[model samples]
Structures are given as C-alpha cells and as structure tokens.
Target chain A: MFEGLYSALEQSEVITLYRHINPDCDALGSQWGLATWLKHRFPLKRVIVLGHQKMTNGLFPDSDEIDDETVRQSLAIVLDTANVRRIDDERWQSARQIIHLDHHPQIEHFADLEYVIDHYAATCEILAEFFSTVDQEPLEADVAEYLYRGLLTDTLSFKTSNTTEHTLAMASYLAQSGLNIPQINRDLFDVPLKEYEFASAIRAEAQILDEHLMISVIDQAFLDRWSMTASQAKDQVYQFGGIREIEIWAVFAKDHDDQRNTWWAGSLRSKTLPVNDIAMNYRGGGHKNAAGCKCLDDASLNALIADLRRRLKENQA
Target chain B: MFEGLYSALEQSEVITLYRHINPDCDALGSQWGLATWLKHRFPLKRVIVLGHQKMTNGLFPDSDEIDDETVRQSLAIVLDTANVRRIDDERWQSARQIIHLDHHPQIEHFADLEYVIDHYAATCEILAEFFSTVDQEPLEADVAEYLYRGLLTDTLSFKTSNTTEHTLAMASYLAQSGLNIPQINRDLFDVPLKEYEFASAIRAEAQILDEHLMISVIDQAFLDRWSMTASQAKDQVYQFGGIREIEIWAVFAKDHDDQRNTWWAGSLRSKTLPVNDIAMNYRGGGHKNAAGCKCLDDASLNALIADLRRRLKENQA
Candidate 1:
C-alpha cells in the first residue's frame, strides 16, 4: 500500500512536508509524524515540515522555512489536505516531486502520487498504520504522540461517527510506545479559565429559536470582552453541540471588511441535516453536516436562520 | 479467577445484584451487565438487580424491588461498592451467600468471596475481561453495551489516568459485538438544552480565587431557577474540571433541613492536590483528588477554601 510513498522517500534526499492552511491537530500530527519517522529511519535525509499557519494551541512546534532553491529540489509530501488550493505552502507547486496523503475525499488532485483514503477517520491513522507495518520495531514515544494527537482530535476523542474498531486498535498500537495518554488528551482539550468563561458566555447568550435550533451571535463588543477574533469566537460553536433538543446550531461572529463595512462570519452544524447547500447560497460552503458562510447584514443573518429552520422542517417532514 | 464466581453462579437458582447508592454509570453497568449475562447464560436462574436510587439520566433502567424472602434465599452479588455501608440495598447481609466484585481498593471483607482489582479503570473493565475470557463465543450485544458504558464513563471516554492499552483492547473486544459505539457515547453524554444553560451559568458564576483555585456557590434561588436539587446541581462540578490554571475547583450548593435552616453541600476536585482531608473535617470524605463535604455556614465554607489553598501552597513549596 505504501510502495510508491516509501520508494519516493527512499529516492529523495530532500523531503518537505505540507498540510492544509489553518492546520488542525490531524494535519500537524500526520505531517510531523511522517517527518520524524523519515528522519529516524534515514538520518541522511533532509526532512522539513513547511507551513505558514501556526497551531494556536501550542500543542506543536512551529513549521520550518526553506528557501525557494530547496523547495525546487525537494519531494513535497502533503498530509491531511484534500486539494492543491488548500495547501499551506504554495511553494509545493515548485517542488521536484509531490505526494499527497489525505483522509479527505478526493478533490482536484495535483500530486505526482495521490493517496487518499476517505474512510479513515484521520490522516494520522493512515500514517500510524503505515509506520507500524513498514518496520518491526515499535514507534518512538514522540512519533506515537504526534500521530495520536491528530487521531484524538479528528475523531473527537473517538466520539465521531467514523470512529471504528480499527481506530481504537490504531490508538492502542500508538499507546504501546509509552505516550502519556491522559496528559496528551488534557493538553489537546483542557481549556484555560478565560476560554471556559467564554464558553459559558456563549451558552448563556445563545438564543434558542426552537427545540430544534439554537444560535449565538457575537458582535464586536462580545469579541472585545473576550479579547478574541471573530474566527476564534466562532469556534465556540461547539458549546451548542451534544444537546438532545438542538438538532441545528449556528454561530455568527461580526467581522469587518477592508473598508470597515460590517459583515458576519457564520458557522453552521447539524445532527443529520445538510448545511453545505445553505452555506453555498451565502457564498460559502463545507460538508453536509457542518458548514460555514457569510452574512452582509442583519437581514441576511435572519435569512440564513430562516433557511436553516426550513431545512430542519424539511428534514422533519 | 472464574472458579469461585462461576461456581457460585452455577449453584445459585436466585441471584440478587446490588450496587452503591446514588449510583454512577459504572455501578449500574456492572450490576446490570452481570445480571444480563447470568440470565442469558442460565435461563432458569432468576437474576434480580436491587437498588433504591435511580439513574437520573435514564441511561439505564430502574432497579428491581424484590421481597425480603427472595433476598434471604438468594446469593447476593455486590458490584462496584467499596464497603458494606454504601451498598444501596442492605438486605445483602440476609442472603444465603454473598459475592463482591469491585475495582476499588479493598476496604473490608463483608462478602464470602471478594474480587477486587484496584488497578482496573472500572469494575466493568474487570467484568469485561472475566466475561470475555470465560466464554469462547462473543458476548451478546446487550451485555457488551452495558459493560462498555461503564468503562467509557469511568475512564471519561478513555481520558482518565488509569486508562491503559488494555482498556482500549477491552473496548475493541466489546465493539466486536457490533455495538453502536457512537450512539452509546451520545446517549451517555448528550445533555438537554437546560443542562447546557446550567453549565453556562456555572462557568459564568464561578469565582477564580487565584490561578490555582476556583469556586461556584449555588444558592436556593439558583437551584429554583434551574428546577434541580442541590445534589443534581452539585453534579455540574465537572464543568470546573480540565482547566489549566485551576489546580483545585469546587461547587457548594445550598440545601435546607426540615426546620428550613440552610446548609451547604460541596463537591471538591483537584488536578493533583488532596482534598479528602478537608472533606473529613467537614463530616465527609472521599478520594484524595475528589471528595465531598458539608459546611454549616459561610464561615465553614471559607475555612474549607482556606484549607484547600493551604494544601496547594504546600504542594508548591
């Protein structure tokens, strides 16, 4: 299964890893896990993890920077990204060769060798399986921890629908490296008191439109009180999740254009209803159950909510 | 390991199962899991689960009520309770024979046969291992689901300190029964909108005494707003957990005596500091990191907080 990827690694003296922009734990996990393994297995190889965006949680180290000459000569292996447009470092287009390793559905592929397994819960799951099978020795603690973080977050601590027996088996395999499981979970999940306060505020201020729908609107004042960006505040949409009565939850955080015109950046989630269609209607899009969009004004926001309520009603019917 | 428990099961025609008062998932899971297994394995044997308290969440069915004559004739099996005093149904003493299975440290030997393995993450973990090994065929879906619920809750979805590779392996074994793991997790954890609002209120109302300590005081008025009892309110203490700065967090809910005099019931938790000593001083005690206590007045609550602060200070020193 890993023949082409393994041969590419063995053939390339210089390898640079990249992942999607606004990288999550799984992206960083798969990128660094494979890099760490490559460096260990072939000490002479020049391996680099290249990305412009940072993991804001401080769970991972910063990405490496290389000159254009190095990018032009390196084997650029992209991890956890579905398509070329989302690659954090566009310099991958200039690399001597490209290999895409992803768990997302196949999009417009640009890699010389594309490997996408959508059924896997996380990109790190594939990497863990690959690493464990390619060698007889157990993975080092650092490598296992890096890969495990991605698996943990992407699967939402194995609470997501895609989590399977194989997922737990892979987790058990990674855990055998003596990684501190509780501490890692704590590091990835444990929030600061301020964030807790923010979540509390979100829940407190949330407007329950009906038994099936809930919404939280974060304006400039709310953002100022929490000292966070609109995007960051929007991330608290999860606070509305896992409520039995709330089949659909949305968060709208007020942002401004370059001209300082008011706009609302919105995130939408559902238990089973499709949301990406509504997101696309507002010049934004994502998956069926979870999506993102924008609103130009209060009327647009109201329209968005109305559209979601309609979707819920349609689903009920 | 199986010789004693299995022989007792085989010899008994009527078996009564008991667990601790105000039972959590582990207690109920172990009791019902064993009862269900025994009933399936021996169709003629009557297995009854006896408990007075209800699982407020409705995750498990209500306990059975049996006549004293049945208790006196049956073999009583106590699961998940550490000591005799805490058992929900005290009629176990009258049973013809008694068997105790628990994962807590052995407090006393009240049962004729005791199986205590403190290292296991949950009593359900021990039960799962026992059931899987004793039978070559896979456990029925209902039995595996019941036990899996306990293991999942006790380990906090495998995030607890005690969770090991064996825990995941046991979970995998349970998953082999084609259990709907995601649905079980959802049922075990998903809360109603009102509870979400209450959690928000707790976080909003929490007082950060310092970087190391946080407290939330819930009065009768607050309980009335939520339409929940002080004990039910106290269960929200977990909302204060998993915070990076707060080494110790607590919740004190006001309850009244028959005379209408107000008192406070408190739940305390710490990341590493011991709070049981202070709890013992306040007419209560529990594990080192987690404990419960009572305060007669505001001054006593202050004193308890002071004691916790002192413990944290000592640890830092």
Candidate 2:
C-alpha cells in the first residue's frame, strides 16, 4: 500500500510535508519524522516541512518557507490530517502529486492517493511499518525519536482504545533505535506555570450536570481574566477528561465575536458515549470518543446539554 | 538468581504474596500477577495475596485474608517495596521463607532471598523477564494483564525517567498475551468527579512564593470543605508537577495530630532540582526529584520555605 508513496519519495526532486492546523504532537512528529527520514535517506533531495499555527508544546522545529513554483514541482505528503480543510498548507493541492497518510477513519475522498489505517494508533505507527517493509535503510535514532513522539502522543502514551499489541511492537522497534523516551515525554507533557494555572481555573468551573453530563463554560470575561483566547481556554477541557462519573464532558468558551450575536465554541470528550454525532448536529464533529462544536447562544447550549443528557441516558440503558 | 525462588515456588504448598503499604498499581499488580501465575502453574498449591491499605484506583480485587499459621507455612514474596517498614503484612516475617522481588534500590536487606533490579521500570517487568526464563510455563493473558497494569502505571505509561528499551520490550511481551491495554488504562487512570473537583481547589489555592517555588496549602478547614483527608488532598500536588518555571512545588495539607499538635504534611516535586535532603531535614524523605515532609507549626513551615529559597539560590548560582 505504501509502495506508491515510497516510489514518489524516491523519484521526486523536492518534497513538502503538511500537517493539520492547530496540530498536536502526533501531527508534528509525523511531519518532522518523515522530513528527517527523507533528508537522511536522500541527502540530495530538498525536503521541507510547513505548518501555519505554532504548536503549544514548543517541541518541534519551525515551519519552512517554500514558493508556489517549488510546491508545484514537488511531491506533497499530508500527514496526520483527516480532511482537505485541515491541511495546513493549501499549496499541497498544487503539488505535482499528493499522498495523504492518516490514522483516522476515511471521512472524505479529497486526496489524490490515500493511506488510511483507521485502527492504527497513529500515523507514525503506519510509517514505522512502512519503513520496516521498504528495507532500503534502517530507521535512525534521530528519525525514530520524532516517530516515537507521534506514537506516544496520539495514543496518550498507549492509553487510547486503538492501542494494540502492534502499537507496542512498533514503539519497541523505534526504541531499539535508542530514542530518548523519557526526555521526549517530559518535553511534550511538561506545562508552563500559566497553563497549569489556567487548567485549575477550568477545573474549578466544571459542573456535573444531570448527574452524568459534565459541562464547563468559560465566557469572554473568564478568558479576558486569564488573558487567553477561546481556543486556549477550551483546550484545557482535557483537564476535566478521564473522569469516571462524567459520561460526557464539554467545555464551551464564548468567542469574542464582533458580530451582533455572541457565539460559544468548545470541545467535547467521552469515555464510552457517542458525542461526535451530537457535535456534528451543532455544526462541529470529530471521533466517537472526542468531538467539538459551537453554539450561537445560551439557548443552543442548553439544548445541546439536554440532547447530551438524553444520549447519556440512552447509552446507559 | 531466580533458580532458588523457582525451586521454592515449586516446593511450597502454600504461598503468600505481600506488597507495600499505601500500595500503588505497581505494588498491587505485582502481588496479584505473581499470585495468579502461581495459582495457574501449581493448581495444588494455595496462593494468597495480602495487603493493608487498599489502592485508591480500586481496579484489582480486594486483598485476601489468611491467618498467621497459614503464613508460617507459606513462601512469602514481597513486591515493589524497598524496605521493611513498607511491608504491608507482618506475617511475612513468620513465613517459612521470604523472597523480595522489587524494582527499587536495595535500601535495607530484610528478606532471605532478594531479586532486586533497581533499573527495571516496574516489578512487573522483572516478573515478565522471570516468566520467560522459567520455561516451565508461559505467562497467561490474565496474569499478563496484571503485569501490564504494573508496567503501565509505574512508568506513567512509559514516560518516567527509568523507562528503557527493555521497559517497552517487557510491555510488548505482556501485550502479546492479549492484554486489553485501553480498558486497563481507563480503569487505572479514570478519576472520580469529586477528586477532579478537589484537584481544582488545590490549583486555585496554589501560590508562587519566591518567584520560583510553587506551593498549595490546604488547611483543615479546606479539607473539611472538600470532605477529604490530608493525604487525599496532598495527592493533588501532582496537579502542579511537570510544570515549567516552577523550580520546586509543594503541597502542604494541615493534619490534626492526636497529640493536639496541628502538623502540615505534604508532598514535594521538582523538574530540575533536588528536594529529598531538605524533605528529610523536615522529618521526611524520598528521591531527588520527589519527596515529602511534615511540619509541626507555622514557624516550621516558614523555616522550610526559607531553606528551600536558599537552596534554590544556591542551585541557580
């Protein structure tokens, strides 16, 4: 399945890598790992990594600049991204050929070529398998470190449901290259004092509504108080995650919209319940266990809560 | 080194397993894992697991009950614990023979036969290595699940400084036995709503003293308000851990001693500083990065803070 992708990498004079916007460690890891691997294997090839938004962890390198002409003549590999809208660099569409590699379920057939393994824990896992199969050159420690970061972060260090025997095997194979697991972990997980403080405030504001549904509202005032943007505050909703009693959890942060109506955008997560469909109904969506959505007003928020409560009851039954 | 222990297991008709007091998942997993393996291997033999304080996670079964006479005739194997004071069961002393299987450094030699590997990620990893070596029988999935739990929790899902290539290898070995990684992860890590709420209170109460040290003080009143014990509230100190900019972090929870002295007992953590010696000076001790101490009064707390500040200055200098 990866043969075509491998061939393209070998044939192309220039390669560009693009990850999803607002990227997580997995996205950055895959992007950087592939770029490093390509640069090491084909020293003469020009491999560039590009992304718009900077990662919050500050672990990976900054994005590189490439002109439209360069991209038009390059092989573009979009990594850890599910759809076209998420591709950080729109120039990928203008590339000579596009290869989409992802671990998410096939949502849209937008890519020219796709390598989607929905059951795999991460894109790095798929790449690990590809590297082992290609037999051109063994994965080096430097490249392995970046790939391992993706595997570790995407599975939440192998705590996610998609984690399997193969996940550990791939991780062990990468570790054989002497990746610094502990240092990478600390670099990715360690938070700043301000982030920790903001997380605490989010937790304090969490409410267990309807005995099973958890909701946390961070209005504009709260965001201003913390000097944080809506996305910055809503990201802390993960602090409310992994709770046993809360069947479904959501964090709504009111956007500082200049329009006549105030809107609240947020993220939602669940351990066993289905929240993606609910999020989709509210003009946002994601995986079954995790999702996101936005509401125009307080009434819509209440309705979403009611719908979530109904879903929780149905799931329990 | 495991020759004598394997012989003892084969010879003994009654076997008792012991773990450390205030047991964590590693302690419980090693205890139950070895017991389950032995029970399956030697069906005629009696296997009992004994512990005092139950684990907060409540993922495993309750500790079994056995009288002193039974222990006296059994081969007792203690897991995870480093010293005699931490042994949960006193009857282990009366056992016909004692075997210590631990991953911690050799602090005090109390057992007759010791299998201690300080560099191993978890006691369960040691057991996994032992199982592969014994060759009499293979490790079953049921036993592997318990071992996997220990490996997962002890290393914080393989993020701890001690995690090694062998750690990933041992975990992969266990996963090969069909362990449910995701379910076990959720069972172990999922927090209760009340605990999450209390963690927020701890964070809200956090203080940045001396511009580098972070502290969260939970008085008796605060504990009462949360309906939590001093230890429970103090555990929230982890909420402040792995944060950048804070040289040292501490959680001081007021404890009402029976002797009419109001003491403050707490846990201390640091990202790049040594705090154990200072903690030892305050009537407690632990590793260089993590430690604990108890103070008898406000003056003692102030003195400890001053000492920490001085230590920080010295470290910086």
Candidate 3:
C-alpha cells in the first residue's frame, strides 16, 4: 500500500516527519511510527520528527528536539495532516521532496506525493501496515507502545465507527509484539487529583448557549494555574457530560504564546452542529462534530457566534 | 439498506422494544425512537418498550418502563443489545415473534428476525433508517430528543469511532425537532458534588494490576451512602483520562438487588481492554472493551481475573 511512498523516499538520505496543528495522537503516531520504522529499516539514513505547533505534552511523553534547518535538502513526509496551512513546519518548502499519508477526507492536497487512504481507521493503522507489509523487523516494545497508543487514541480504543477489522487486526498484531496494553492504559488514563479539580473548574465555568448549544471560553486567566495542552482543555469539556441535545459544545482557550493576539484557540463539538463549516469560516477546519478555529478578539468571537446562531437557525428551518 | 429488516417486521401487529441492561441514553433512545415511530405510523398496533433489566435510575431523568409479561406475548423487538444470553428479557423464548436491531458486532443467532447492522454508528441510526423507510412522521421534540440522546450516548457525542456521517445527519435531523440539547446535557452529565467525593473514594479503592489494568469494585455500602448508579460508577472509571498505554480500567459496582451474595455488575471502558470476553466466561457478556458479569465472591472474581491474565498472556505469545 505504501510502495509508492517508500519509493519516493528511497533516494533521499535525510528524512523528517511533520503533522498538522493541534496535533492529535494519529498525527503524532503516524509521524513517530514511520520515523521508528524508517530509522530502524535504513539506519544509514538520518530521520527527524518535528511539527510546527506544540503537541499535547501529556500524550507525547517522549520527544525529539529537531533543528528546522538540520535536514539539508532532505525528504519530508507529512502524516495525518489536512490543509497545508496547518502543516507543522514551513521547512518542508525547502525540502527536496514531500510525501503525505493521511486518513482524513481531503480538503487540500499539500504534498508532491500523497498517499491518502480515507478508508483506514487511523494514521497509526497505516504506519503499522507499512511496517508489516515491507517485512520490517517487529516493533520494539516502546515503539510498539507508541504505535498502539496512537491506534487506541484515534479509534477511542475501537469504539468508534472508523474502527474496521483491519484496525482490530493491527491492534491484535501490536499486542502480539508484547506491547503491554494495561500499563499503556494506566499511563494514558491515570489522572492526578489536581487535574480532577481543574476539570471541575472548567465545568463550573461552562454555561449554556440557548438549548441547542453550550459555550465556554477558557481565558488564560482561568487556565494559567493549570498546565495543560489545548487537547487537555478540550477533553475537560466532556466532564460536564451528557449534553445529548447540544448541537455544539465549544471551548475557546486563549493561547498566550500565540504572537497573533487575535488567534485565540477555539474548539467546537456538535452532534447537530455543522461546526466544521463554522470553523472553516474562521480559517480553521475539522469534522462536523469536532472542529477548531481562531478569533482575534471578543468582537470577532461574537461575530463567529452570530454566524453559528444562523447555522443553528438553519436547523430550525 | 433495510429491505431485509423491513420485510421481517412488516406484518407484525405488536412490537416491543428491548435494549441491553443498565440502559444508557442510546439504549433508551433506540427504544423510545422506535416506539415513537410506531406510535405515529402504526397507530393501529400496540408498541411497548421492555427490558430484562432496569437501567441505572439516576442517569435517566425520565422513566420509560414496561413489564416482562408484555415481552412474552408481543413481537419482541430487541434494541441496542450486544449479546444473546444477556438479551434483557428471557421472554424471547415465548414471544410470538422475535426481531432484533442492534449495533454491536454479531454475538449470537438469537433473533428469528434479526437486523444486526454492527457497522452503523449507533442503534438510533438503525432506528432512524427504519423510520425513514416506514415514512414515520418527522420526529417529535421529545422523541427526537430521546433519539438524539441514544445517538450521543452510543457515539460518545460524535467523538468515538462509531460515529459516521449518518450519525451526524441523524443528530442534525433530530436537532430540527427542537428538544433542548443543553438541558439534557446538564441533566445527563452534571453529577452532584457528593458524587465527586464518591468518585474520589472509588478511585482510592481501585486495585492496580501492574499499571496495565486497574480494577475497582464498590460494594452496597458505598451505594447506600452515595445513592449513585452503576452507570455513574462506570463514568468514574472513564474519568481517569490521559494514559496512552493502559489496557483495562474497570469499575465493578455491586448491584444490591441482584442476589443475596452474588454481586451482579460489569465494566465500561474506552476499548482499551477485552473485559467483555472476561465477563462472558463468568456467565456474563458484552463488547471488546465494555462488558459485565457477576462474581459470586472475591474468589470467583479472582478466578475471572486469572482467566483474563491468561488471555492477555496468550496474546503476547
């Protein structure tokens, strides 16, 4: 399945991996999983994994610091990314070649050589297939642990619709490689007492947006005390769980490091809300139920809210 | 997609809905959504919702009940069931006719007229398709709200792998029916402050299995003080968020009414472990990550644990 992808990278001596902004496990897993595969397969080649944005620190417990200019005219492979605007590093523009492997429905094609499989469940699944297909050595436990985590995280542990027999088979195969399922689970799920308290604070801060939506924007003031990634902030929103009727549950957290003051990070969810369409309006994107975007100020955020109300109004029609 | 299912139930005059035990919103929504559809489209016939077990009461703010005798006499329509033996009502044996509609993977060949579309996102998706085929009235606000709940609960509010385009579409369609999403959310997700303390207590009680699987079983003593449901207990287990490697995280709460000594209950998870299979071996059954069974005593539960460890060990081999 990845024959063309490998062939494109075969000639390149140096390789780097990148993912989209607000990097999810799939994006990180694909990037990291492939890095593990390639570095192990071709030890002679230099491999690097880097993304432009900061990932959820809690999820990516292991990291490799990369110098953007380190890969002299090498190949860069972007995995589990969508639009080019969200690409982790612009250094790819200086690379000699670029390849893309993703499972998302296409929005914009970014790579010179793209290997997108919309049918696959997760990006890690694709990477696992790549390693298995080429008869590469079996995954090392820590490497297998990361790959498995990506699969479990992306598939919500095989509870989602995207889970296919292939996903399960790959997970089963990874388990066979002696990746400890329970320990990985504990590390991923064990929460500190403070985190629980922070989640309560978020829930207490959240409020309803009409009967159809719930909205909360966690300003830096509320979040400064609690160290968390955007995804952690997003996951905290589910704690006020059981909002079945909510077409959209939104969280806009202020990221102070953002040089663009107007670029307040926003997260949206809706079983009924066409949030991706709304996010697109803000020059961001995601699926219908979960999407994110940015707003410059209260004025812009209010304008976005007005637009969302109109979308909710459309449902009324 | 539903032609085969339509024919099996076309001639039936009476239909009774069934869902898995300890019902969630999706379970209820699947049941209520179908009952509402029948109420309007087949007004001449009688439709009832019945289950072999009662749901966790506190979670469901409203009551929708039926007697077992109804299942024995009517055309039993089981909804959202995962396994055959655990079919809510044993009345399936004597029911004049039996029809099954479920979203879980095929577990058994119990239903004489079964519609098992495991690939569909939620049980409500199956009902949505069935209603669309039957030309049922556009969903009522309450019915639509209930259906939306079922969809959200089962789909984990569009975050799980089970979510599909159809899942979102059905949620959108239901949103048009005007049931309050935020209100339902508040009722569904908002646990009392007391429950938080209870959750803390439960977490403290959990037994760690090498940081791989964490098991916590609360007895009746905990229940009386907190007045929490098994569903709430499960939510507490899921609250430990962020570990990427743990496989099985379970909350086995005692169901006081089950028997004098046998503790009847099961576990819920994010598909990290195969607890359902473990539950099945103990005369219980469920899905890959979510399953329940009874432990007549601590020794029985320990034997069950031994079996699970054996399976995980086999996987490593």
| Winner on TM-score (1 vs 3) | 1
Per-residue C-alpha lDDT of model 1 across residues A1-317, encoded as one tens digit per residue = 88888899999999999999989999999998998989889999999999998978987888887899999999999899987788998999999998989999997878899888898899999998888778887799889999999999998998887787778878888887877887898899999877877878877778987578999989999998889888888888988888989989989999987888889999999877889999898878998888999755888888888998898888878
When 2 and 3 are scored with TM-score, the better candidate is 2
Among incorrect, acceptable, medium and high, the docking class of model 3 is incorrect
CA deviation > 4 Å runs, candidate 3? A6-22, A42-76, A82-98, A104-112, A119-121, A136-140, A155-169, A189-192, A217-235, A240-242, A252-265, A276-287, A296-310, B1-317
Model 1 achieves a DockQ score of 0.65
- List residue ranges in candidate 1 displaced over 4 A: A3-12, A68-73, A93-97, A112-114, A135-138, A315-317, B1-13, B65-75, B93-97, B134-138, B314-317
lDDT of 1: 0.88
What is each candidate's fraction of native interface contacts (fnat)? 0.74, 0.76, 0.09
Q: Which candidate gets the maximum TM-score versus the true structure?
A: 1
Q: How many pairs in model 1 have backbone atoms within 3 A of each other, for residues 3 or more apart or on separate chains, i.e. clashes? A: 0
Provide TM-scores for the models: 0.92, 0.90, 0.52
Give the 10-residue window scoring lowest on summed lDDT in candidate 1 chain A.
A202-211
In CAPRI terms, model 2 is classed as medium
lDDT of 3 by residue, A1-317 (tens): 67787787678788888888878777877777778777767899888887657665465644456665665477888788778888877677777788888888788876788878888888788877776777755676656667877876886645455655466557655655655555565555556556756665676666666666667778766766787765567666555434445566777777645574534678777654567987888867988767888644677788887777788878889
Q: B105-147 in candidate 1: lDDT tens per residue?
A: 9989999998899988999998988898789977999999999
Q: Judged by DockQ, which candidate is best? A: 1
Ranking of all predicted structures according to DockQ, beginning with the best and ending with the worst: 1, 2, 3
Candidate 2's error at B303, in angstroms? 1.4
What lDDT does model 3 reach?
Answer: 0.68
lDDT, candidate 3, B103-128, per-residue tens? 88887777777788888878887787
